[model samples]
Target: MSRFSLVRSAPAPTPAALAAPPPVAPPAARVESKPKSPARDAGLDLRLRLHAKLIEELDLAKLDKLDEAELRRQVLGQVTEFARIERMALNARELEALGASIYDEMVGLGPIEPLLKDDSINDILINGPYQVYIERRGELELTPIRFRDNDHLLRIVNRIVAAVGRRIDESQPMVDARLPDGSRVNAAIPPVAIDGCSVSIRKFSKKPLTLEKLVEFGAMTQSMSDFLYGAVRSRVSTVISGGTGSGKTTLLNALSSAISEGERLITIEDAAELQLQQPHVVRMETRPPNIEGKGEIRQRELVKNALRMRPDRVILGEVRSEEAFDMLQAMNTGHEGSMATIHSNNPREAISRLEQMVAMGGLNIGADAVRHQIAAAVGLVVQVMRLSDGKRKVTHVTEITGMEGQVVQMQDIFVFNRTHTGPDGEVFGEFRATGLRPRCLDEMIRRGIPYDTANFDPSKVLG
Candidate 1:
């Protein structure tokens, strides 16, 4: 029987005839003597088995022909009829939850559907069928969600990849993709993963974060935002450098909002994630090779193609490969206000990394020549990083001041002084200028871009 039997632990001070003890002591009395607790229902296993049978009996042909409303009605009818046949009983809430789970298993990524719908979950990492983890509010926690087995996990992965017109198998075990909502997804299976399929999803926010919002989050100060706005307006070729998950793309999205709506912008990425609200923006993404290993479109080709598209500014999502050379050439060539991001910790490291990437382009140029090109092409490198307490901040606003001797010369006008951490583990620091007047200020003013050098005085600190 699915019904719960409540047995009182203590004798009743006042009793009625209906409460009389059973002719033979009640079966529940043996358990009530031990502890005072509510009775646990024993129908959980039966309900699970019934759910599986219903799913197995589902007719895909009939299901496919119905609209959402019709589908829900049909599924609900089948569930209710099945429960009646099995002599099972469920409360209203339990019935609704089971209906949702069945629908999700048939139509979505089962077990993780709720996580995907949660706006607060920033990341969803599925190690295998038996374990699922999610990142919420910058903290990682294990979840009770799981697939039936490894094969079940693989089925979901295949469904996701197939929707994107891609596939991952033994021959090609790792792939990058995006969900319908534009969340970035990466999957590695079997041999490389060792355990099973490993899937990482970087969730996309529906509302793009703004500079004002970032200030509220203590990501940057008002003065810093003003300086960046002025710099972008001055048509400075800028690059954002940061480690992974350092809010490079989020900051870039915020910065791109400052671009004049009149200008045409072309953005390129392996997976398009930037949400530029400008009306005249064109976005493109690279395509991977087919199963036979042919027909690949790399970012380097896109960079070369963007030159002919008459773009007022080109936004390379990231400069990571031979494309770095093409990106530099674009900046040197008349697309002076172009912007891109690179993976680096500091300005000096970013410059060195760019130089190395230039060589990666197979250009037969010495380091000095590459540094010369960088010095003339790039104007600023803004370094951002995630603090220990899970805060992201613009750490440095550096100016590339031409070549000094054999190296590229750069100076940090503003920097985050990460002096120490507080007792609560919050990063304690202040953003301050390095006391050097930016040479860009003079050029910015000359170009009719309003810039005030007073805000960058070295003696003043900003937080």
Candidate 2:
């Protein structure tokens, strides 16, 4: 038999094999059993032990002074050395992966670093130590990534919040923060989370999407984009309405690009995520109360304060509560190009939600007065929706003309008429112009904003 076949079907040790010298290990190489731990993968123990040893021996201060490339190289070298010293049976590829994981644990968010590095992943959802999910291309899928245990996951959660100067624990229970790249983060732990620690991250694109990019993605037609550009430049107050994860903020950001460079903009959010490209922009974020519950800053307060900042326009990240009242006030009282987003099914529902949120401010004004205020303030309601096929499109671009008594008058300028879903689950639809000329058209003309009147023709079907 051949030597390989002899080894595979060995009945007894060959005399030549028994006489060969044993393989030599590195001088410092040694193997030791790890202390017993619950919920940790058996494969993870060696890497964890090597990581701990590297941490114990590395010069952290010196490493921090090096640039990223050099830092990675030196850290990886140490990781490989420690892996060898611990007698790890890793091939070259496995060693490289181990080194990268250890490097990320040292300088990044540990287990989920790879997911964060993946630009295509739009969201990261951590249900617990053992379950992680990612939303890629608008559809959710489970991933193999996991923490060593619940404590490991909590350490990551705390690391995230602590970097942003926030706290999440039994006392606070929940917190909202943003990554350095402006991705929104929400975390809950322990008593409130029920299933260990849970974290939801809404990641934004590194390069923000513009209106033209949205057009290429079939989000809106060129005519709609033209109308929106004219509307924003002409100082039309607008509200973007959409359901959760339906691209409200994305549309708002794209629309903000239409504003003049000379205009000073102020943005407010629960966790600041808007990427307005204007030079003269001020961003504000709300704060949760301390453990004493005395230092909370709400969006309503920020909205009121933004008015004092002499802003040419106020761009609210969202109008979630009583802040809707203040936002409408800004839109009415000379902050004409101001914009905000709201959660609703359609343009009419968005109007109703605004009226309800205005009441939430505990104002003494009657409902008809509130409706009139909304009608006067918001010039357009751009409704966006994520369809069943995972594609987001502008479903409606309805204009608020005025109030017809207690009812606020509105007209659909552009509407997406869905025909059917294809066999491959793609939504088939056409964006149609209602042909009803918006009142804002006269204002756009008066402002000398160039736009084609034929864009509003009923027969003109847009993409």
Q: What is the C-alpha lDDT profile of model 1 across 1-463, one tens digit per residue?
A: 1110111123322223212332423333323223222232233233344445545555555666778877766556655655555455777777767777666666777778889999999999998666789988677899867665566788889888888888899988998888888788899998787666899999888888888898888888888887787778778999999998898988898998778999999999998888887999999889889989998999999999999999999999888888999999999999988999999999999999998898998878988888899999999999999888878889999999998799788999889988898998888888888878877787768867776567777677775
What TM-score does model 1 achieve against the real structure? Answer: 0.85
TM-scores for every candidate against the unseen true structure: 0.85, 0.89
In TM-score terms, which candidate is top?
2
For model 2, residues 203-260, the per-residue Cα lDDT tens digits are 9998889999999999999999999989998999999999999999999989989999
Model 2 error, position 206 (Å): 0.2
* Global local distance difference test of model 2: 0.84
Q: What's model 2's lDDT at 127?
A: 87
Candidate with best lDDT: 2
Q: Which residue pairs collide, candidate 1?
A: 435-458
